[model samples]
Target: MKRDFAVIGLGRFGGSICRELSMEGMEVLAIDIDEDKVNEFKNIASHAVIADSTDEATLKDLGIKNIDHVIVAIGDNIQASILTTVVLTDFNIKKITVKAQNDYHEKILNKIGADQVVHPERDMGKRIAHNIISNNILDYLELSDDHSIVEVKVGAKMLGKSLIDLDIRANYGCNVVAIKQGKDINVSPSAEDKLKEDDILIVIGADKDISRFEKHLVVDE
Candidate 1:
C-alpha cells in the first residue's frame, strides 16, 4: 500500500517537510490553525486545511485516522504539540513524529507516545558545529540517544584494510553503513571489502564510538 503523511503546523520546519514530501510523490495532507499558512502550502501538498490541531474532534473530522503517519510541527506551542500528538495516538495513527522545542518538550513527547521527536533547529546547529570541529567528518546524525550516524573520509590510515581485519564494529562500536566512491555509494558492503584511501564511509554508532572511529582515520608518522 502507498504511504500517506499529514503535517500539522505550517511553520518553517513543517513547511519544508510538506514541500519535500509532496515533491517526493507522497500524498500529504497539510494542516494549520492559520489560513494563510495553509494557503502557502497549497498546490504543493496533496491536500491543505486550516484547523485548530489542539482539538481532537477537529482532527478526527479531518480523517486523521486514514493517514499512515502524522507529523506534529506546531511551533513553540508545547500544549498544542502535546495535545495533537496524544490525539493522533488516541486515533491510533500508525506513526507519529513531533518537533520539540527543547529537552523538556522532547521528554514530554517521548513519554506521551510520539514515535519520534525531532529537534530540527538544535540538530542542524549541532551538525554544522560538528562539521566545523572535525577534519575527517562530513556530517553527523543522532540516530538515538545512544547512537549516531556519521560520514567520514576514509583516509590513508584506513586504506587497503579489510573490514574483518580492522574489526570496526568490535573495536570501535561502529558499523560501516555504506562506502562512497567518487559519485557512487555501495550500501550493504561485504565484510571482506577493502577500504581505499579515497573512499568515504557512512558509519553508524554511539557518539563516543564515532569519535574513536574518526581517530582511526588519522594517519601516523
Candidate 2:
C-alpha cells in the first residue's frame, strides 16, 4: 500500500523529505505559504499547495485528516511550527514529525503530542564532530541521551580478527549489528566472520562503551 504523507513546509528540510517521499512512490501533499516553493514542488509531489498550515480551516479543506503521516517542518518560525503541530494533533494523525528550531521549541512540540522531533542541524554537527575526532568513525546516530549507534570502519588492527576472536559484546559492551563491505551488507554476521580492511561495522551500545570500542578497535594504532 502506498503511504500518504503531507509536508507542512517547503523549506530545505521539508522540501527534501517531499522529494524523497515522492521519489519512493509515496503519495505526498506538499504545502507551504510561499507560492514559489509550492510551484517548485508541483511536478515533484502528488499535490502541491500554498496554504498556511497553522490555519485549521485551511488544513481541513485540504483533507489533511486523510494523510497517513504529517511532517511539520516549518523553519525558523517556532510559532507556526507549534501551532501547526497542535492542529495536527487534533486530527489524530497516525504520525507527526516536527523539526525543532531549538530546545525550547522541542519541549513545546513534545508537550503538544508531536510523534517525533528532529534537530537536523544539531545532529549533523554531532556527526561531523565524531568524524573529525576519528577518521574511522563514519557516522553517529543518537538513540538516547546516553546511547548511540556508530558506523566504524575496520582498521588495520582489526582486519584479520573474527567476531569470536575480538569478543566485542563482552569486551566493549557493544554489538556489531551489521557489517558492510562495499555495496553488500551482512546483517547476521556470524561469530567466526572475519573483518576485512574496507568493512564497516554498525555498532550499537551506550555512548561510553562505543567510545571505548572505537578507541580500541576502530582507530589505527
Candidate 3:
C-alpha cells in the first residue's frame, strides 16, 4: 500500500522526512518558501514545490487532500510553523507532525491541532544524558508519552540468573523484548535463557519504571 505525504518547509527535518518517505516507495510532495531548498530536494522528493506554506492558496493548489500525512517543519519561525499547521488541519490533512522549538511552541502546536509535536533538540539531549549517566544503559528510545525502550548491560546483580528466575516482568512491570550478547542478538529472549554479566537487554516499559529498574543495579552504600 502506497501512501502520499506532503511536507511543508524544506529545512533539515522536513527534507529528511521527504527523502526517507520517497526512498520507502511513498509519493512525497515537498514544499518550501525558498526556491533553492525546493530545488535541492527536487531529485530526492517525488515532487518539490516552492511556495509559502502559510498561504492557503498554495496548499490548495498542491492537492493537499490526496496526502495521507502532512508534516510542518518550519524552523526558527514559530509563527510560520503554527500558521502552516493550522492551515493544513483546516484542510483536513490526516496525520500532521509539527516541529516545536520549545515547551510554549509545543503547547501552541497541540492547541492548533497538530497530531504530533516533536522537540528534536531536547529529545536528543535527553538521550545523550541517559547514556552518559550510566555505563549500564546503552541506549534509550521513547515509545510514547509514558513508555520507552531501553538497552542496558546485565551487570553482576543479574549474572547467572535465568529470565524466569529474575521475574523481570513481575518485579519491574517491563519485558525484555530482545537480548544483545556481543555481536549476537536474540529477539524475544526466552524465559529459560541465562543472563550473563555483559549481556545487553532491550527492555520496554514506562519511563518511570525504567528509572526504577536502573536504580536496582546500584548497590546501596
Candidate 4:
C-alpha cells in the first residue's frame, strides 16, 4: 500500500525525507513556513505549501489528518516543534516522528506522545565512532540510551564456530537475531549454525554488551 506522509519544516532533515518519500512513489505533503523552502520541493513533493504547521487551522485546511505518518523536523525552534506536535496529537495523527535538538527536547516530545524521536547528529556521531573503533562493525543503530542493534561482519576469529560453541547470549549478553550470508538470511538463527567468514550478524542487546561482543568476537582487520 502507498502510505501518505506529511513532513513539516523543510530544513535539511525534513527536506531529505520529503525527497526520499517522493522518490519512493509515496504521496507526500511538504509544509514549511518559508516560501523559498516550500518552492524547492514544489515539483518533488505531491503538495508543497508555505504554511505555519503549528497553527491548527492551517494544518486542518491542508488535510494533514489524512496522512498516515507525519514527521516534525522543525529545526532549532523548540517551541514551534512542540506546538506542532501537540496539534498533531490533538488531531489523533497515527504516527509522529520528531527530530529533537537535545536530550531535554526528546524527553518533552516523548511525553507529548510522539511515536518516534530521532537525534540525528548525536546518533550519527555514535555510529561513526563505533565504525572507527572496529573494522568488522558495519552499522550501529541506537534503540535507546542503553540498547542498540549492530550489524557486524564475521571475521577470521569466529570462523567455523557455531552459536552454541560461542554461547553469545551467555558470553556477551547479546542475541544474534539473524545471520546474513550474501543474498540469504537466516532469521532467528539456530544454535548449531556455524559462523562463516564475511557473514553478517544482526545482533541486538544493551550497548555495553554489543560493544563487548564486537571487541571479542569480531576480528579487527
Candidate number of the best TM-score: 2
Q: Encode model 2's per-residue lDDT on 1-221: one tens digit a residue.
A: 88999998989999999999999999999999999999999999999999999999999999999999999989999999999999999999999999999999999999999999999999999999989878989999999889999999988878889999999999999999999999998899987878888999999999999989988877776
The pairs that clash in candidate 3 are none
Q: How far is candidate 2 from the true structure (C-alpha RMSD, Å)?
A: 1.4
Candidate 4: tens digits of C-alpha lDDT, residues 98-166? 999999999999999999999988999999998998878889999878999999888787788988998
lDDT of residue 112 for candidate 3:
80
Error of 3 at 55 (Å): 0.3
- lDDT per residue for candidate 1 within 147-181, as digits (tens), equals 88888877667779888878888998888889898
Model 3 local distance difference test score = 0.86
* Candidate 1 regions with alpha-carbon error over 4 angstroms: 156-171, 187-197, 215-221
Which pairs of residues collide in model 4?
A: none
Report, for all candidates in order, the number of backbone clashes: 0, 0, 0, 0
In model 1, the worst 10-residue window by lDDT is: 212-221
Rank all candidate structures by their TM-score, best first, as comma-separated numbers. Answer: 2, 4, 3, 1
Scored by lDDT, the top model is 2
Model 3, span 1-221: residue lDDT tens:
99888888888888788888989999999989899999999999888989988899878888987799998888899999988988888988879999999999999899989999998788888788887777777788887889999898887778888889888788878888889989999997888878887799999998888887877752221
The TM-score, computed over Cα atoms with residue i paired to residue i, of candidate 4 is 0.92
lDDT against the true structure, each candidate: 0.87, 0.94, 0.86, 0.92
After superposing all C-alphas onto the true structure, candidate 3 shows an RMSD in angstroms of 2.7
